[model samples]
Target: MALSKVFVSLMLLISLISTVSSTGVIGGKALPPKKPPVAVAPAYAPIYSPAPSPIAVPPTPAASPPVYAPVRRLIAVQGVVYGKPCSDWGHDTLMHASPLPGAEVRLVCHGKPKENPLKIMATTDKNGYFFILATKKVSEYGAQKRCRVFLQSAPTNSKFIHSTHMNGGLSGAYLRYTKPAKPLLFALYTVGPFAYEPLPSVCHQKV
Candidate 1:
């Protein structure tokens, strides 16, 4: 009839807008609101690269303490430390041999370090000749009217007489025993010798 009612009213308005655009109500397009599901931020559980810190311990070095030395004896007195034109006591030389043959000769036994302490007994061999034998505490070594002996050319092989004297002699050694003491024959100390003038006098009488 009128073009079949304008083609059946545009075919019922395009079949009610394609049946409300597939049920999304109205002329479709509200489907865009579903974009809320695009929040895909839940897959970050694989970043396990963290674990390194522990190593530091090194410091240790401390332990040392102990040393006390002093014990020497063997006394036999009958000496000689000549130099300075020395000869006579059996008359043997015009200074025979020792201008300084590794010097050092001391027999300090008269109230040593303190009361009675000087017993380096003996030392001097290598053409210098020294024979010590004084260490028995000499009856506890306590009766010093005198027993002073010294020839400290610093013995112990005085480096070939300090390489050739300069002040080597330093001279000294003396004795004056008198308490039933008499076995000291020819005590000759040239470089140096003393008793009241050498050095000795502390004090002792114990037993």
Candidate 2:
């Protein structure tokens, strides 16, 4: 009797297990088989187009600086030359000294009553005027100022440095004087002892 009971119990347990599985009780439903994961294609990097280079804007040019010229000292001289009347000088009575074309003239400054005066020379215009005539023509000069001057005719070799015992009736000083030579010289000279040395010295050098 016990052997039969044991067999019967075994069969009953097997039947219960099968029924539980098929009925889906206690989470016994058959599970779908898991497929292997699909192979993933590697994502390609986006094609590299070099990033557009930024357009460079050029900077504006700097403004140019202003330029200036040096100031020139301007002097004015006016006078009559005696025989220096140019070819155009019409009459003997016309302001004969107005201007003499082609006459070369000079002006001078003396370091003192003794030393040779500093000389500045110029040729006359058609009007017989010299801008560089003499420094005393400037408003800022005086009589008894130690100076001597002479004029030379170019292309003619005619020089007319003048000789004077009394100029402008002043006693000691020599002044701007005129000698009447168209191509001849208009110059200044002294009767004093100092005159000889410089006259010949200058005459030899330039005249």
Candidate 3:
């Protein structure tokens, strides 16, 4: 009617530019442009701290005191030898005590007087006894602080005479300290009845 109302307003402006170039959200349902709110950096949920438990120390008790070892001692000695027939046959300490069989005892000491004395021989058994095991390396029983018992020999058909006062004479017969000696010896001595005295029949001056 005026060219059909200007051709119906130019065909309604080309149908609204072909619905905004074929649906890039011109009319309603295409909602994708509010990008500025994306700064939501607060949701960082990584807080996990739970791992630490182990502390136990208790054990110390042995307070010092228990160490022992020391007990070693040794020594041994023994004796017997007697005879008495002539102080007139009776100085009677039991009427002339016999038993001097095969006698030959010696164990004298007093060392270093030029080193040749400390005898140590033994012989008198048949009832006369006489044992000797004393030793601290060659026995004078402890090698010399004291030692004696010397009747060196007596039995040439019995004429005997070593009664240096018969043992109570006391200048000897010492060294007597027994008990304790077994693979362990330092000193141990035992002396005797040790006596001898028969000699009063000498009549021969024939020239």
What's the distance in Å from true for residue 20, model 1?
1.7
The candidate maximizing TM-score is: 1
The worst-scoring run of ten residues by lDDT in candidate 2 lies at 189-198
Give the local distance difference test score of model 1. 0.42
Cα lDDT for residue 73, candidate 2? 29
Instruction: Please state the error at residue 132 of candidate 1 in Å.
Output: 3.5
**Each model's C-alpha lDDT?**
0.42, 0.42, 0.61
Clashing pairs in 3: 1-4, 75-180
The local lDDT score (0 to 100) that residue 117 gets in candidate 2 is 55
lDDT for each residue of candidate 2 in 54-121, tens digit (9 for 90 to 100) = 99999989998888864322233333233322321222233323333555444555565576655665
* Model 1 TM-score relative to the real fold: 0.29
Model 1 ranges with Cα > 4 A deviation: 1-14, 17-19, 22-35, 42-108, 112-130, 136-147, 150-207
Q: Candidate 1 on 54-111: residue-level lDDT in tens?
A: 6776767666666666433223454334332122212333244343333455555555
Ranked candidates (lDDT, high to low): 3, 2, 1
Compared with the true structure, model 3 gives a TM-score of 0.26
Per-residue CA lDDT of candidate 3, range 1-207, in tens? 899999999999899778866775676767465567556567787998888676676768778898776433333345666776554343535255778777777766665668776566778787877776644445433443545777677755765554545553235666655555464444556665766666544312211
Comparing 1 and 3 on TM-score, the stronger one = 1
